[model samples]
Target: MTVVDVPGSKSLTARALFLAAAADGVSTLRRPLASEDTEGFAAGLTALGYRVERTPERWSVQGSPAGPPHDTAEVYCRDGATTARFLPTLTAAGHGTYRFDASAQMRRRPVAPLTRALRALGVDVRHEESEGHHPLTVTADGVRGGELALDAGESSQYLTALLLLGPLTRDGLRITVTRLVSAPYVGITIAMMRAFGVTVSRENTSRGEVFSVPPGGYRAADYAIEPDASTASYFFAAAALTGHETTVPGLGRGALQGDLRFVDVLERMGARVRVDDDRTTVSGTGTLRGITVGMRDVSDTMPTLAAIAPYASGPVRIEDVGNTRVKECDRLAACAENLRALGVSVTTGEDWIEVSPGTPRPARIATRADHRIAMSFAVASLRTPGITFDDPGCVRKTFPAFHEVFARTRAAWGLAAAASPDR
Candidate 1:
């Protein structure tokens, strides 16, 4: 048995930071993720004059309801795509001239959809050199939000940025989502917004979904973030790979994060799962059977599932994951490449990947500096030997102590196995 305590949700931490900064008073975030991406977001907010303090147990953010205190600031968003996209919207809502830059990796991602939508809302967004990329400037006298239409085909963070900024606008906002890529993330955004005391009405329309947010700003409140289910997936997959039981505490049926649904996919794949109010436990039934799944909503776990595909009883087909191509790396291609490197038969199309059972061989996986890739392949290493990673340090993006915790879990499981008389 290996019981692990996964850290807080990165998605919820990012959203909490944005909402807390725009709030009326001091907000305390309990058990928030302390990672490069999340810490980078907090630092960016601090540069805009929000007081974010991190203690051992929690983080306290002093709100700036009247908008960011600085009139001119240069903020650096590292590899965190959520920070890069969401920070610009937060800057546009303030009365300032903010310049945003990113790391070499974040520089390649798409920011045009967000900037285009902001321009429609009457904000001046300019790209310094490359258009639709990072290293841009935003001149804001405060957003005059009205009915706005935008495409979130590339990433769901675009819609989340607007939804977070909705209540702060002069006339509120009526957001008609043209095309939503990752729809379930919007649900997390909506749930977080409501927790901070704002209501956003989402209705299905002929076009897509229209979100209506009221004109009142956010209210500061003490928030407890759920464990990162995306990070927890590796451990659950480990349990499914080995005939053992693994429990991730602080996550269950009431989790606010969308990635928790990954457990449901595992259950469908022949793993026994127990979900209560406090924890989620996964027990392997000695063998895994593959299943077809649409990962648009919980696509972050695609690589993790793909890692386990070769060990399963059948083929695993993942669909509706075109957005995986534009993430930290070309995740779909990366998964296929890594799977093939391990001698697994993998097939990939524009938005789907099907992996079949094969004898996993020794291979050094190229992580492409993507945290999910590093972690996913690491999970595969538990079942098969000689699975090395090109960039193991990339796990620092979300879980800095991931390898350390994983080793401890492995040691605990080894001890359990050695002590078992049946073994």
Candidate 2:
């Protein structure tokens, strides 16, 4: 069995950065993912006047529970959606005039839900160019948080932003969420909040699911980040495509990211899976079965499964992932278009895509500069020769050396690949 060490979780790293920066004292994060998105998050904190120190192996943030030290700042959140959505809310708890903007890709993604909730909570948030889009300003007078309601159907970041802001509020916050997607991400936020010494009580109510957060601020603590399960999906997909055995360390039974459950999807696709205390392994049995799955919670992996779907014996239909349309790009359409480019039979709806069994032909994939698109299609290239990506380096957003790592892994398994330039 070949063992692969995936980078730290982007979701965990982003949340940890927010928690560490908002805690009461110095906070240290071990083995944080060093990438465009995460570095952008740390930079956003620095722009807000928070002290953050970075090293090759760890990151240290000096927390300021009272909010940002800067009275005014302008933060450009690179292609990271979490940085765009979360940092503005972080500034809301501080007394400052903060202007936030992002890349064209991020600006296209919706932030109206989160911005709407912040406006309702009495923060002066304004969209400079387009309503609910970035190039926005937040004139924070400090949040005197109380009861509020939210709709998080498009993205869970809105709910997580509110949950993160709860401790910094004067009266705490009681949030009732009307609709939520990617519910597992909120679980990650709550668990991290507890690690920072805050408790968020959640329950089902008639109106909706309610989260009651106390007014006391967070306490700093040393935290270790787990390996990214979403990144590991590409590696796991590689093994499944080539009938190899691959093991990824640092993600096991107690892993927090919802994307880790991707192994279950693999298991359903006729792959052998083993989850242990410190690692998870996927072994191909040389038979990939098609599946119809609802990927509402694990939509990030939809591209991963879609990239490998043509290898299945039957049909692969992915459903309940409408939120994916607003991600870095319209993932469903991207997958369908790329697969069709490979001469594969594929059909798509607003929320679903169905791929029929066929041999994927040689074609160049259009990455659209989305990291997941680049990485997921890389897996498809393991089986189809001459498959290349338009923008392979876009993987720098999460895994900067994705092409190198994938090439080495392919060589180790004695499998030939032609995805990224490095291959």
Q: Which candidate ranks first by TM-score, i.e. highest?
A: 2
On residues 258-326, what C-alpha lDDT tens digit does candidate 2 reach at each position?
A: 998998999999999999999999999898999999999989999999999999999999999999999
Least well predicted 10-residue stretch by lDDT in candidate 1: 414-423
Cα error, candidate 1, residue 417 (Å): 13
Q: Write the per-residue lDDT of candidate 1 for residues 1-423, one digit (tens) a residue.
A: 578999889999999999999999999999999999999999999999889999857999998876888889999999999989998899888888999999989999889999899999999999988999999999989987899898998899999999999988989999898888777889999999999999999898997789999988999989998889999999999888887899999998888777888888889988999999989999988888979999998999999999989999999999999999999999999999999989999999999999998779868889999999988987787777666777778889999998788878777777322111111
Local error of candidate 2 at residue 201 (angstroms): 0.8
lDDT for predicted candidate 2 compared with the true structure: 0.93
Find the 10 residues in a row with the least total lDDT in model 2. Answer: 414-423
Candidate 1 regions exceeding 4 Å error are 415-423
Instruction: Please give each candidate's TM-score.
Output: 0.97, 0.99
